[model samples]
Target: MKEVIRSADPRIAALIARQATQNRDRDQLGLDRISALLEAVGRPQDRLPPIFHVAGTNGKGSTCAFLRAALEAAGKRVHAFTSPHLVRYNERIRIAGKLIEDAQLGELMDRVLDANEELGASLFEVNTAVAFLAFSEAPADACILEVGLGGRLDATNVVEKPLVCGIASLGLDHQAFLGDTLNEVAAEKAGIAKRGVPLVTQIYPSAIAERIGEIAHDVGAIWEPRGLHWEAGVRQGKLRYRDRQGAMDLPLPRLPGKYQAMNAALAVAMLRHQSQIAIPASAYGAAMGWTQWPARLQQLHGGPLFAMLPKGSELWVDGGHNPSAAQLVADYAKRQWTDRLPLVLLFASLQSKDAAGTLRPFKGIATEVLTLPIDGHECRTPRELAHLAESMGLPARPCSSLSSAMTALAKPARVLVFGSLYMAGELLALNGPLPD
Candidate 1:
């Protein structure tokens, strides 16, 4: 059964891959294709439980993780769908707190592929349809859907009425698809808002905020902008949340980084604002301490990667690839290494990313940069990355492979593997480590 699924369905894979490569010009902003595909599948998207549709350039995944954890803590069965799976394709679809089984994934893919034979739907569109189909068939109290791309025409946006829509920390990314400016990006993320739904968002620059607000108002969504409707701050080693409903004192999120606190707060606010799921205060605390999103500032342990490092040595991995993510990573590393800094970085990014801007934050923080390829994806050559590092006054070397890079480390030094989530997935698979 696994073989049948794993074997290349050339016709399907080729079509999907082709769609992934197509330039999504702004003119291509409509849900016609996705709606048609879903309708052929019996409109499973309409049958889903209350959805928490999230869109952003960063922090959206962590927000989704917090939402699922909170719902599960309240003893509710939650279905979740995320994108660009780190390791297994199954990671994209979760049913009632479990990754979709191989057989079920295969069946759903078959149905979607069959339906798209004439429609030529994009890979994301087919996958979105499959996720809705599975979520509808399964019994769950709520669903958390993460946007696969810019929200306006993103396949996931086909869901007309989400319980609540959220836009996390936004930044410039996918410039080819989205736009060049931050305001353009904000408008794209804000496209998930629906009529009468609460569109929760983090505070952005005034111009960007106004654009998002305009989009929300245009859609008739009640915009719950941060600093106005809800806010959260870290004080006394805890996160304090306040909104019109009231205030709540919550423990810090188990997830590392100060940014996660905001993501957790967004989840809490979205839940608090919605009426479908009755999440108790206890669930908020549980979410703060129980949620874990892998490959985001994750410290590697008990794996082949760990074995290669010296005892007491710290090794961390994050899939952060853009400038905003780079800034966050820099802030976290700076706080973590006030006394001791990371020895080096094994870094690589897709051809389209701003490699120079992304690595700028690591200047002076990393002892050296060892560049390598991100398998199964278009990647910048290690030499290219090394040149960029050199231009920025950082010591760097291009390595042919990860093993070669690891072998070059002389002693136990803190190391970080970053740049692309696809690379992180390859590392986890090679180390036989499964995401929790």
Candidate 2:
């Protein structure tokens, strides 16, 4: 899908407007167009530093964040590329430990798009191209990349070789694109396993793990699934990770949810498994608090969105939309704070997602739900979502808009804004701390 990116910078806005006209979706999984486009623009991927590529249904973004944090904490200049920018399109590409400035971003986008006008590249592909061009030219010690979609045909998969590859928590998501079965999904994720690279992954069901293993073997990747070649867990309020190399009992992640520790552990294992980069064990401890992935169980503070909530109410925003992701959010809600105030779920999601299944997990956990349409995309109407919530046994009602929802929400409660990353981006723009 073409991303509708709104930028305050006029230069960036122009580039985004031009990119919109060139956007086209890839009906099948392959990298012929992107690879050609990259070659046309001067194969920038070949110039990147030690690359840390990550893929999975979930937690991959967090794993990339942890990897960047750890490498930077170890005094390395890092270049990171992640998908679905929260607040700005520039958020997708970071150059030498800082977000690419508007001038730099606009120039890069124009250069890539202008050169590949007939290449028929999508917004994500062009964005990937821009990142590679920028990262290649910039001076950085390491590169961290998160797979935009499935690993096999993702634009970022153009990387022929990387220092390490990791797969985070797997789950049922994007069945329409990847596959309906867990084994198929696992194989799709394991496609990032490059020859001679460590394919670090979370422990999966036996069948799914074996499928991933098969892919690794086919690709000649070093398969290092958890509970086999490596192990990590949350124990005694600490994240303990161990492998043949050694063990490091690190602190928990600053991000909310118990699962973040495992994501951090995946990053540590990737670092430990590879020798291209020299990362200290102490950096792993620092990454526990150093990593910051916006909208992943992130709490808002005195923002425009937070001000809408009733007094004494808390506000948290998470962009995860899958049912497994919703369960994690529900679990965090149940464990994090006492229910002194009612839990109000302010939700919206894409029409393609299993909205009913995603919302069902939070049926009893949320005291009330306020549904709103995710603007600029095909989304489940508020009435439809409200009906689903009602069928799931929770009282839900649709509002005309977020402003209207805020106006009607006068009762004190803990509010969580859930759904698509597009919604998260809108919230961040209206609120503060816009993805620096």
Candidate 3:
């Protein structure tokens, strides 16, 4: 994995190598080390612009994308910090609506590493501190921070105040860190809510919603749920949003999948609720047409990988690995394949994931499954995934690599390469750079 990481600066490469080695030896999920690291770095987290912090098992990245688009649409500069860069480490830190430059990123990493030499900070913690340092020095209207793990103890939770906080779709993920149940997961995500801040959320089961509300109340944060404080619906090809402030009609999200509408709406609601930057109605309309999140039902277009397939073939990629995400993918595919086209699945996942549960949703929809391995993660062997697929009554084959699986395609089929972000990263690197 280190060999594949590309940067124009040698210092950036050295910093990444050192952090990767440190992570391999001392990676743990908690805030104690991160807190000390940030303190050593001059407590940059406290100096960020008004922040919009978000957390969830899925859709959090999409939500961040929507927020950036809306802020940029309003002609305001925005700083965004996300996790697990699909192809480049630069993707994790966006300063003023652009990926951080290699020289600047290298310098920031060196400063962070030097300050936290004895703290043994994990890779994610060090990355988070660097982002904060950059954001603190740069000028931006707002900052969007996405939780890298369970929110309560996530490295991004050091912010004491934010303009707004949001929790996108929640489900069972990272069970070892968060709890096993949906309610428990909701509670962990709700940990980002700060005193006097507005926390927006999507509709959820009563139990899950109640738990999140309890956490919000405990932290002195105001809970503004979708169905209660505001609401959004799609009608006649438009998104109808209504809240106490007022009502507005905006274009539907340009992103694929019905779930994205909720994410876009959440961003709209958060912007509308906060008056920090004065987002006009026009910005809301622009966001609907401008936002895009890659690797979430993304269609491959005009690339080496696409040319290898039959004419008019569709190749899609999604990095959804949890059971809840699997169900969403299955539902989306059911609607997409209503014309009854053959669906071929090229999949890989980490070892800790439940392969059976994740693949169960596509049992009837997927015509065949090609199981492969995620190159750098502790993933299930291709043979093990094949056995799981067979038990589920789905035709399965083991492939040594993604290239091998693509070569076995009989015709131009509606192919889906999913199951892990690491696999999606590899595909994007091979196909071409992601669309700007």
Candidate 4:
């Protein structure tokens, strides 16, 4: 998906526009161009601090957030890189405990573009190179790198030796780039394992877990699957963790939904198994309440967009666009809003997504689905989505915009804006909290 970015700084905007025109598909699923691009920029990946590389179909970003919060709470300056920024491109790159400033971001983008005079790299490849370039020069104790795509060929996988690697909850997503089957997707995520490095993962099905074990064995990695080596969950209104080291009782993540408990546990597992940094038990508890990932069950307290809605109405948003993600969202909605009537959904998705499968889980949960087209991308048409929803026995209607949808609603209700991350980003811009 190509993003049409709007930056507050003119210099930064101009540099981003210039870099957007070079080799869009050159780094679709390979590291050749990225390696050359990094070499041109002095091979910064080799000079960085200890890295904690994370990859999976879902909850990987949340796991990275958990890791950063715990590290920071322990008085460590942490650098983090996450994808599909909710509002600005600056959200993708975070320098030592802060979002990169405008002047430095412009300078870094310019430096990377200037070095790639002969090499045509994709936008993501250049962005990855810029992250390593900046992290190498900045002073930080640890770095958390999230894989933008599948783990095997993602540009972030160029790091030779990481302190630890983590794989979060796995499901079917990006089938065009990864594979259509669960086994193939698990393999792509397991490729990040390195010799002598601990690959801490949330337990999967028997066959998928065995497949990942095979890859780790072939690469000489220490494979530690959950339920065998370490495990954690909300047992009695408190998070319970147990491993070979010991057992820990911690607070659950403040993030909504039950799935977040596992993500926080993955971060705890990664931090505990690694020897690079020493974190106190208090820091792990601090992370549960401190960590926040926007557009994932985020509620709008007050904003320009909120004033347009009806009174006593609640607005929630999420960036889940796959079948597995939708199932989780539906579960959260039913458990949270069972008493509320007229559960409305304003949704859109990209062209390559499985719209039918994505909407299947929410058929009976939604009161009315308002379909809209996402701006500046090849998105599903509103009429097309409405038809699909109807086929699945859902009450759906096509609308031109949010205002039109609001006017068409019959009564007060709860609204959930979900489907595409790109759509979630646009909604956040209209809503509050632009990712600092």
Best-matching candidate per lDDT: 4
Model 3 per-residue lDDT tens digits across residues 1-436? 1223544467787887777655533536778888999999899998899999999898999999999999999999999999778888899999998899888998899899887667778778888999999999999999999998879889899898989999999988878778899988898899899999999999999999999999999989989999999999888988899999988888889888888888899999888878878987898899888997888988887677777777767889999999989999899888767875689999898888877889999998999999999886789999999999999999999999878888888777888998998899889888865635
> Candidate 4 lDDT, tens digit per residue, 75-126?
9999998897878888989999899878788888898999776777878887
| Whole-model alpha-carbon lDDT for candidate 1 | 0.86
Weakest ten-residue segment in model 4 by summed lDDT: 20-29
lDDT of 2 at 374: 84
Residue-level lDDT of model 2, residues 1-436, one tens digit each, is 4346677888888877887777566454579889989999999999999899999888999999999899989999999999888887788889988988888888888899987788778778888999999999988899999998889989899999999999998888888888888888888888888898889989888999889899899979999889999999999999988999888789899998988888888999999998877888889899999999999988887887678778887878899898888988888878876657888888898988988878888877889999989887889999999998899898998986766777678788887888788887778888777888
Provide backbone clash counts, one per model.
0, 0, 0, 0
Q: What is the C-alpha RMSD of each candidate to the true structure, in Å?
A: 3.6, 1.3, 2.0, 1.3
Error of 1 at 173 (Å): 0.4
Q: Model 2 misses residue 40 by how many Å?
A: 0.5
> Which parts of model 3 are misplaced by more than 4 Å?
1-10, 21-27
lDDT of 1 by residue, 260-360 (tens): 99999999999998886798899999999899899999887767766776666777889999999999998998887776635689899889899998999
- Cα displacement (angstroms), candidate 3, residue 337, comes to 2.5
**What C-alpha lDDT do the candidate models reach, one value each?**
0.86, 0.87, 0.88, 0.88
> What residue pairs clash in candidate 4, if any at all?
none
